[model samples]
Target: MSTVSVREFSYNPSAVLARVEKGEAIQVTRHGNVIAILSPAGSPMERYAHLVAQGKIKLKPVTAAERHSMPHYEVPEDVDPVALLLAEREEDDR
Candidate 1:
C-alpha cells in the first residue's frame, strides 16, 4: 500500500493509474481524511457464472398465481385481455 496526496495523484494521473492497474491499493484523502479507494472493476459475467455454479441463483418457476399477480397495463376499457395477449404472442412469434 502507498499513500499519495490528491495533488500528486492529479498531477501524475497516469503514474497513479499504473499503480492501481497493478493492484496496488490507494487512499484518496482530503484534509488528512481518507475519502475513496481505487480497485479493479468486477466482471458481471464471471460473477453470474460463479453464482450459477454455486447453485445460489435459481430460475423463478412459473405458476397460475404468478400470472395473476402480474399488473395489467391500462388501456381503453373496451380493450379485451384475450385480444391483447394474442397480439403480444403474435408479435413475439415474428
Candidate 2:
C-alpha cells in the first residue's frame, strides 16, 4: 500500500500511475487526510492483467524454512567469491 498527497499527484501524474502499475494500492489525500483509494477494478484476472501490462507484477517461488533445529554448518574457506555471489543470486531467483 502507498499514499500520495493530492498536490503531489497534480504536479506529477505519472508517479501515481507508476505506483499503481507496480501493483501497489494508493490512497490519495487532501488537506492531510485520505480522500480516495486508487486501485484496480473488475475481477481478479482482469486486475492481474492490468498490473502485468503495466510491468507491476512479479512472480517468485516461496520455500518454507525448516521448522526444527538443525546443526550449524560453515562454508568452505577456499570457496571463490564470484561463485558465492552467483549462488546467492540463484537462490534469490528461486
Candidate 3:
C-alpha cells in the first residue's frame, strides 16, 4: 500500500495511477485524514468469477472455433465514412 497526499495526487495523477495499476493499493489523504483508496479495476472474468463460484451464474468457456464464427464486415475502398456521417448530421438538422 502507498500513501499520497491529495496535493501530490492532483499534481501527478499518472504516477499514482501507475502504482495502482501494478496491483498496489493507494491511500489518498487530505488534511492528514484518509479520504480514498485507489485500486485497479479487475478484468471482466475476475469480476464475474465470484458469482460463478457462488452458483449464481453459469459461464461457458468459448472454443477457438466458436470465437471465430461471428460475422465480419469489410469497408469498401471508395467509402468516405466521415463525409457520410457529416452528411447524415446535416440531414438531421433540416
Best by TM-score: 3
TM-score of 1: 0.41
TM-score ranking from best candidate downward: 3, 2, 1
Query: Which is superior by lDDT, 1 or 3?
Result: 3
- Where model 2 places Cα greater than 4 Å from the true spot, the runs are 42-94
Query: lDDT of each model, Cα atoms only?
Result: 0.62, 0.63, 0.70
- Give me candidate 3's TM-score against the actual structure: 0.43
Q: Model 1, stretches more than 4 Å misplaced? A: 43-94
lDDT of 1 by residue, 1-94 (tens): 3567788778998988788777665555566655555544552233343443344663343599997998677667799967998998999999
Better lDDT candidate (1, 2): 2
lDDT of 3 by residue, 7-72 (tens): 999999999999888876666778875666676787445555445445576556568898799545
Work out the TM-score per prediction.
0.41, 0.42, 0.43
Cα RMSD of all models vs. native, in order, equals 17.2, 14.3, 14.5
Error of 3 at 18 (Å): 0.9
Superposed by TM-score, candidate 3 places the C-alpha of residue 20 at a distance from the truth, in angstroms, of 0.5
Candidate 2, residues 1-94, lDDT tens digits: the string is: 4668899889998978787776666667787666665765542344444454354663232345642454344558798755877887899999
